[model samples]
Target: MASETDLGHALPASLSRPVLLSAVGRVMKSARAAAFTAEEQNSPLALRAYDLRHAAVSTWLAAGTPPPLVAKWAGHSVQVLLTVYAHAVDGQEDAARMRIERALADDDEAA
Candidate 1:
């Protein structure tokens, strides 16, 4: 039998696709996601194995990974990456408002 371990990667290099899917299924069966609604348990939700890739991409983007690099890693065109992952980038409105307030306060102090 071939070696299954992959150095530096959580997924083994030789893990069969079916086994990988089964592993994800086992985790989902035990995770809180198992309690989710039928709609919430559908594809593109965390219940599916593919959702891990979505989470990974979204996480990298949320952690400030550059768009071009993310696109490259995701094997997508920059435009497609931006369009698809836009929903992953959230919660900037409050930060922007605070920055504007700070800038205005600094201007008032200068004046």
Candidate 2:
């Protein structure tokens, strides 16, 4: 992620809160409509809404948010949340292992 300083350097001087807010509102409205349509159609035959919620919870968990906070955002009880999404949390372990292996690989010059 870019730091605040990086953002300050990248953005134009005339950038305004109202312009950003309007853009964000449009994007959010489009995203919500898309989600609702997908959910209504059950497009993937497995309920996109459920998948979307699972993804949100998984991302929050991977980002180190506490389980209680994830539960609150997901509107699930902590027990149910943990039980249902335990496998999703395992993905983070896999990702960490991959990152470690990549970091430990021999340098091209050394090899």
Q: Pick the candidate with the highest TM-score.
A: 1
Which one wins on lDDT? 1
Model 1 agreement with the true structure over 19-68: per-residue lDDT tens digits: 66687678876663557776765645575656778899998887767788
Candidate 1 lands at a TM-score of 0.47
Residue pairs whose backbone atoms clash in candidate 1: none
Give the Å error, residue 12, model 1. 7.2
Question: lDDT tens digits, residues 11-65, model 2?
Answer: 4445532355566556655666665665644445323345666777887887767
**Where's the lowest-lDDT run of ten residues in candidate 2?**
1-10
Please, what is the whole-model Cα lDDT of each candidate in the order they appear? Answer: 0.73, 0.66
User: At residue 99, what lDDT does model 1 achieve?
Assistant: 74
